[model samples]
Structure formats: C-alpha cells, structure tokens
Target chain A: MTDDREKRRLDNTIMEGLRSMPEVDPPKGFSARVMENLEPKRPSAWTRFRLWLTEPRSVTFTPVRMIPVFAAAMVLLVLGFYAMDTNDSGNGMRMSTIRFVLNDSGMNARTVAVIGSFNSWQAHDAAMRFDDATGAWVLEAQLPPGDHEYMFLVDGQKLMADPLAQMTRDDGFGNRNSIVFVNGTYEQAL
Target chain B: MALLAFFLLSASCAWAGDAGFVKMADRARECGVSSGMIGQIESFTAEGSLSDAEAVSLLLPLVAACADNFPLASFEDKLAEGFAKQVGPFSIVRALDRKLDEFRFARDMLQDSGGGVAQQALVVLGEGLSKGVPRQDFKTYVSMYGDHAPELFLTGLEMMSLLSQAGFDFRLTRSMLDVGFAGKGLSPEWRYFVRIVLVARQRGLTDDAIAEAAGTVLEDSGSLADVAVHLGFTSRDLSGRGLSN
Candidate 1:
C-alpha cells in the first residue's frame, strides 16, 4: 500500500510539470502576415467580365411550380402573337401566324379549305374553320418562303381561286391558279 | 429650264399638229391617254402611210378598248414598241387587237377552269405568241396541271420556256416541269427548280438524267444546297462546265 501511494505521487508531480510550462504565443504580426498572404490579387475589369461571361450557372425549379410558370409563358406568347397581328395581310411568312382568310357568304357551303402547293392541293387536308362572327372561312398555315399556287375548294369540290389574289397563273388548261408570292415580294395596292 | 422649254415646244407643236389627228385626239383625250402617248400616236399617224384620221380613228379606240381588260400602261408600252420598230399605226393597232384577244382568251380559259391566272401571264402569253410557243401548248399545260395548282402549272410553263431559251429541248423542259411541279414547290421553290434546269443545262446533262436527278432532289432534298448535292452541280461547277449557257 505504501509503494502504490509513492507511485501515484510521482505521476501527479510529472503531470504538474507538464501543465506548468510557459504558454507559447504566436510570433508578432502573425495574423497580419497570414491575411496579407491569403488575400487574392484584384482582377482587371476585363478579366472580371470574362469570368462573368464564361461562368456556368445552374437553374432549378420544382416540377409542380413549373405548371403555372409554363401557363403564364403560354399566355404571354399568345398575347405577343396577338400584339403583332396586323390589319394588313401579305403573302410572306414573316411571322408564325400567317392567316389565310376567305370570305364566302350565303353560298350554302358545308366546308371550305385553302389548299395550295404547301398542302399538295388536297382540299380537306388543310380544311378551313368557319368563323361564326365574320361569316367567313379562315385557315392559318405557315407557308414556306416562295411563290405558292393555291385555290379554295368548296365542300371538297368546286376548286376556285381567290378572286382577290395578288396574282394569278394560267393553268395552261382553261383555269386560273391563284398566286401567292411569299417572302420579300411586296405587292402595292393598285 | 431646257425641260420646260422642250415641253412648251412639244405642247405647241402638238396643239398645231392637232389638225391631222382630230378624231384620234378626241378619242385619246376621252380615254385619259397621256399627252406623251398621244404625241407618239400622232407622230406615228403623221409619218406612217395610213390616213391619220382613219388609222387614229380605228386604232386609238382599239387601244382604248383594252383599257378595261389590261393595264392602259401595258397597252401604251406595246404601242411604243410598235413605234420603236417603225411599224405603221394601223399595224400597231392590229397587233394590239391580237394581243388583247390573246389576253382575253388566256384570262377566259383561266376563269373557266377554276381561277388562278396571273396578270403577268398576259405578258407571257403575248411573248409566247411572239416566240412561236403554240397556244395549244399553253392550253395543254394549263389543262394537265391547272386543276391542282394554277401558279405551279404556269410556273412550269415559264420554266419550260426558260429551259428552252437555255437550249434544252421541249421534251427536257417538259420533263423537268413534270418532276419539279410534282412537289408543288413546298421543298423547293419553282424558281429553285428553274435554277436546277439552268445548272443541268450547264453540266450538259441529258434531259433524262436531269429529270431523274430532279426526281431524287424533289423526293429527298428540301433546300437549294440539297438540290445542288443531289444534282452534283453548283455555281462553281457551272463555271467549269460552260458559261456560254
């Protein structure tokens, strides 16, 4: 028991020596030196702009939240089209909504279509929808840029020309084909 | 100042020369014929062999009659052309009458079939008559392709005319038209088809070869580049092939 007590006393004395050593503080101006080395160099305006332009960015959105976002976008897109719609119409496909309109009143027609070179001359293929408000038949088709020969087919038969077509072609037979000179060909009112 | 003086001189001369073209002058004034046109008419009537009173009386109203059917300007141009050729007023009147008839015929045929005839086609019809492209040929082409697309049919006719001008035979021209118009100008414009004809002619490709290539291009090609690729011809290629074409 006396020997055990002596060993415990020796261990306690060594621990006290270790705990009592002088506290070592950092060298003078150490924090200032570290901050001076760590601080980055100021980039030039052009360099900063280069970085800004070339930087890749990630965008995130919830699928559920995207529904209203897409709906709003569609509404804006439709309104944009509406805003760009002009009272004047032309043969050019300058915009997506190039409307082909024909007015036939009191003809007792069941169907009307604006078939042209664009739709392989199949009358019912590009069938026109009747506009109740105007009592007219209208079809909106995206005609490719170039001259197009078209005619209106009434009720799947009775191929007719747009009487007011800007130009017409003699179908070498005994018929006149309505001509639509698309894109870049301007027609001034005679 | 010179222009004004010249105008005054011409106006006074016209007023003085009114003695010869009295009947024509009265009719011309009634039909809104320009003074410049009247000057040409009167000068032609005065210089030509026919009697001014008779030729003017007969021809001036004949031209005026065309005012409703054609642009009066076109009639004026034809009259000017006849004068430029030093043809007599009576001959000019006869030619104008024939042209008016042709225009009426082409327009009637167009209307009777279904309707899609171009005003420019009138000029083309006149040119065809002058170039010896038989009217029956025009009628045949019109009937064959007119039912589906009028402009395409007419454009095909024009393309044939152009190809013929480029030295391709009528068969080749017709063959090109048959193939190109088959697509209704959706993939390639009719003008593009004309370009193909020109290129084919430059390459000295046979009509059969051109027709065959055009079929492939119209079937598979959607652009001028695609056509060039399919036909194995380009603007660069045309230079080496032949510029005389």
Candidate 2:
C-alpha cells in the first residue's frame, strides 16, 4: 500500500512537471509567411485575353488558332444551309434534320452507333455511318438547350468514346463518353 | 551628393547593359528557389565582378523569388544548370547538392527531434510508465497528446531508456511514458498491465505473462530488448520466461 501510494505521488509530481513545462513555440511568423507565400496568383480570363492581344508573337496563337476559327465558320455555314433546306416551315423556328456519321476503328468487326439520353439509349436504328469521301464521322442532331451524355456503341457489344467530343464522364465501367451542351440555338460539342 | 551620383551611375550602368544575369534571376525566381539559395547562387555567379557585399545584396531578392516560385527539386536543377554554364557542372552540382542536403537534413532533424505535442506526449508517457503510475492516471496525463500515441509511445520507450541510463529518476521516465500513451483509448487495466510488464521485462523479471504482455504491446526488437536490458534481463528471458542463472 505504501509503495502504491508513493508511486501515485511520484506519478502526480511527474505529470505536473510535464504539464507545467511551457510549450515550445514554432518559429515566429511561420504560418503567416507560408500563407503570404501561397496566396494564389491565377490570371483572369480577361487578363489572358489582354495578354494575348499584347503578345501577338506568342507561339500559342498560330495556324492552330486559325484551324479552330475556320472550323467554327464552316459549321455556321452548314447550319445556314440546313436552315434554308427547311424553309418550308416558314415559321422562324423550324426543326432541321440532323445527320450523323459513325466510323469503326476497332478490329472487332462490329456495327457502331451513337446513343444518348436524347435518343432514348437505342443503338441499332439510331447509329450514324462514316462518310468515306470526307474521312470524317459526323453527327447532326436537333437538340434543345441543356446538357446531354452520350457514347458510341461499336459492334453491338463494345462502347467506344468520341475522341473529338469536348467533355466526358467516367462510366463506372472504366470508360468515358462525350457530353454536349446546347445553349443559344447552337450547342457546343464537348 | 557623391553617394547619390554613384547610385545613379550604377543604376544607369545596370539599365544600359544586359547583365546576362537578369534572365537567370528571372528564371531562378520562376523556379521557386529559396531566397537564401538564390542569393548564394547569384553571389557565386557575380563573385569576381562585384564586391562581396554588393553581390550578396543583389542575390537576396533572386533567391527569395526563386524560393517563392519553384519547388525544391526544380530550383536545385535550375541553380545547378545556371552555375554549370559558368563554372564546371560537376563542381556546382556537388556544392549545391551538399549545401541543400545539409539544410534539408537540418530541417528534417528538427521535425523528427520531437518539437511538437507528439514529443511532449512521449516525454510524459516515459515518466509515467517508469514510476508504475496507474494506467487511468497516465491516460488522463496523456489525454491531449492526440492521434500519434502509438508512434510516440514506441519512440518514447527508446527515449525513456536513454533517460534512465542517464540516471534520471523514475518520476521523469514514468511521466514521459504516460504522455506517450495519452488519448490512445486503451483501457486503464490494460495500460497498467502493459506498463508493469514493460518495466518488469526491462528489470529482467522472469514472469511468462509479463513477457507475453510485452510481446503483445511492443513491436520492435531493439526497443523490447532495450526495455529488457534496462530491467537487467537477458534476451532469453523475453523469448520465454526462464529464471536467470
């Protein structure tokens, strides 16, 4: 009993000594200096635009920029032609026919098609075909404003992604698909 | 007036001539080299051309800028490359790596040296365990030590042995151990039994239960053996309870 009591007393004294010891402060201004150093310096879009305007010599804007611009203009021109083809509606708002082109790249000898929520996820009847002359797989769909997720169904068994689409989501089965968002009468391919 | 004129002349000279070093400074700044390191490199670059004080002053901002922008690896590489272009590549890489390694080692040493709550916990736990303090009281003592109790306890054991060898009383040793076990959520009974077994094993107690308990609680052979040796026991006693001849 005496030994236990003496041990308790010793323990208390030791604990008190530890508790009484002053905490060692980290070097002063450590966190403040770190925060000051880490402050984000992201350049705004407008700032980027202004920088682009100023530095015409930057390699980032070259034939590369022209290619996108030309493609966009050609897309606009095609839309104009489609609108003229559907002039029979006469009501300024007319639905234009959407044409799609699908190409097969895999060696599986499979029939492929574009499927999306917009097309009720059907593949066989809704699949597009490749235009051999243009060497381009094209899709023309009349989509109302909003966003849509879609993928290419190849050979009825394989699901392929659109390599040229603007955006994608993980399909839980270790694959990704293209997403297109339509706003202001024209939708952007993602 | 003379000083002002000299400053103006220096400014004009700097602006008129491309120092061939401004680009390097900008690159160093971009690469995130430490201000001190940048200063060292810059001074080294300008040593023969500028007086020592002038060179150091010019290099300070470059170093700070580099540290701010570049990560350690990239900054080291760029600094080495810049120096190599002027000095021999081998000499600069070796010197820079040596200095940088020393600084890094010092910082790492400080971190591992137990300057924080973890260290405090270990010191407290060591003290508590050595005195055969009750497990509950030790837990209360170490209640604020946080999530690193296991690591701190393991490391604290080694520290306690060292302190014991240095002739500190059991009061300090037990307190260190108590803090190390603080907030581990182990039951007081288990804590008490564990501490007793550890201490007994350290003292060469030939109890089978005590050896088993020590084996259960401690993972490292060096530490387990250290505890056993501290209590005046041999490795054979730890392997299985056998009376010392």
Using lDDT, give the best candidate's number: 1
Kindly report the root-mean-square deviation of model 1 from the true structure over all alpha carbons.
25.3
What is residue B186's positional error in candidate 1, in angstroms? 5.6
Off by over 4 Å in 2: A1-110, A135-137, A186-190, B1-245
Task: Give the C-alpha lDDT of model 1.
Answer: 0.58
Tell me the spans in candidate 1 whose CA falls farther than 4 Å from its real position.
A1-190, B1-20, B25-35, B43-68, B88-94, B116-118, B149-154, B164-171, B186-189, B192-203, B221-231, B236-245
Estimate the Cα RMSD of every predicted model relative to the unseen true structure.
25.3, 48.6
**Worst ten in a row by lDDT for model 2 chain A:** A181-190
Tell me the tens digit of each residue's lDDT in model 2 across B27-50: 556655455556655666575644
lDDT of 2 at A61: 62
DockQ of each: 0.01, 0.00
Residue A128, model 2, lDDT: 60
